[model samples]
Target: MFPNNLAFISSNQLHLVQSSLLSMLKGALHYTIPLTIITFCIGLVLALATALARISGIKILEWIARIYVSAIRGTPLLVQLFIIFYGLPSVHITIGSFPAAIIGFSLNVGAYASEIIRAAILSIPKGQWEAAYSIGMNYSQALRRIVLPQAVRVSVPPLSNTFISLVKDTSLASLILVADLFRKAQEIASTTYQFMLLYVEAAFLYWVICLILSIIQQKLEGRFDKYISK
Candidate 1:
């Protein structure tokens, strides 16, 4: 028999337990969701810009992009997060932890996603760009209407994976007291003294989030498969 005080075992405790879970979910939605979406979108834009710069005829732009990607990809994300979160405030930037986390994650993702975008763009037959230009589509027009559509198909799967990783990475925000899911779990576990129960529940919640994201990723892949074969 379990300890009578163990919150996990009692029928009447179910509502209380669920309320805690609901609180965790709300925290996740509030803190983690914004971090994920903002980082991914910002990263995507940076990737597009970097990819274009890398391929552009300008040598200075190409070199700048190369340096940025190399620096970002070479550094540990933990260090980058620390720099953004703690290091900048020392220099008077004074960014909030949540926004700093977003910037760090976004820049990190941008470095990796830039390579994916560049590779995707390069994988397209040069003839596609040429064809678009032959039809009087300017560089921007061709890139927007012709090249990017195809590149997006190639980019979606990896980008989805990046977002999944980003979701998991949001746990790092707990270090800064952002009150995300894991932080809430830690709070509950610390107070309730049911470390194993709370931790297992937290782990299960993380797994469920990943599973849901995986399902959506698969659907997105299927949707984009209409454009790219492999």
Candidate 2:
């Protein structure tokens, strides 16, 4: 039989866990989720533009896109975030923590996702473009009407993966003083000295969020597959 005091300790621990979970969830709802959605939407636009530029055959655009992608891919995301949040203040370009996180994550996603988008665009047969031209479609028209639709189907899986990754990466924003999910956990743990429990709780929340996203990704893939098959 357990000691009577053991029950009281267990109850206290349970209360702590529940309260910590609530605080972390609030942080996630307020910052982590919103940041992910906003950054990813902006990143997708940047990715599409960069991908288009790379394939545009304009030397200047290609060079600019290439350098941007190279620079982003070569650096660590944490370093990028640091540069935006910490390093920039020295140059008199001080951005707030949330905005800095958004810019850093968006730029990182844009660079990596551009490559995925570019490959998807390239995977479409030359005949598709030729067929679009034969049907009186200009380059822009073909891209808008024929090519991009097909490329989107190809890119969905990888892009979904990228979004999932960005969800995890948002934890890094804690370092920049964004009160995201992990940051909330850190705050609670520091007070309670329950570092392991709080950190695991945070990880579990992340896993749950990612699991839901994975399900959504699968559904999206299935929907796109049906369109492709038809």
CA RMSD of each candidate after superposition: 3.1, 2.3
- Could you tell me every candidate's TM-score relative to the true structure? 0.88, 0.95
Give the true-structure RMSD of model 1: 3.1
Q: Candidate 2, residue 224: CA error in Å?
A: 1.3
**Model 1: residues with Cα > 4 Å off, grouped in runs:** 1-19, 227-230
Task: Please give, for residues 1-230, the per-residue lDDT of candidate 1 as tens digits.
Answer: 66668535666345546767987898789988788889899989999999999999899999999999999999888888888878888888878888888888889888999999999999999899999999999999999999988888888888899889889988888877688888888898787776776677777888899999999999888877754564
Q: Write the per-residue lDDT of candidate 2 for residues 1-230, one digit (tens) a residue.
A: 87886545466677988988889999999999999999999999999999999999999999999999999999999999999999999999999999999999999999999999999999999999999999999999999999999999899999999999999999999999999999999999999898877899999999999999999999999998888799
Deviating ranges (above 4 Å) for candidate 2: 1-9
lDDT of the candidates, in the order given: 0.86, 0.96
Q: What shift in Å separates residue 192 of candidate 1 from its native position after superposition?
A: 2.6
Model 2's alpha-carbon lDDT is: 0.96
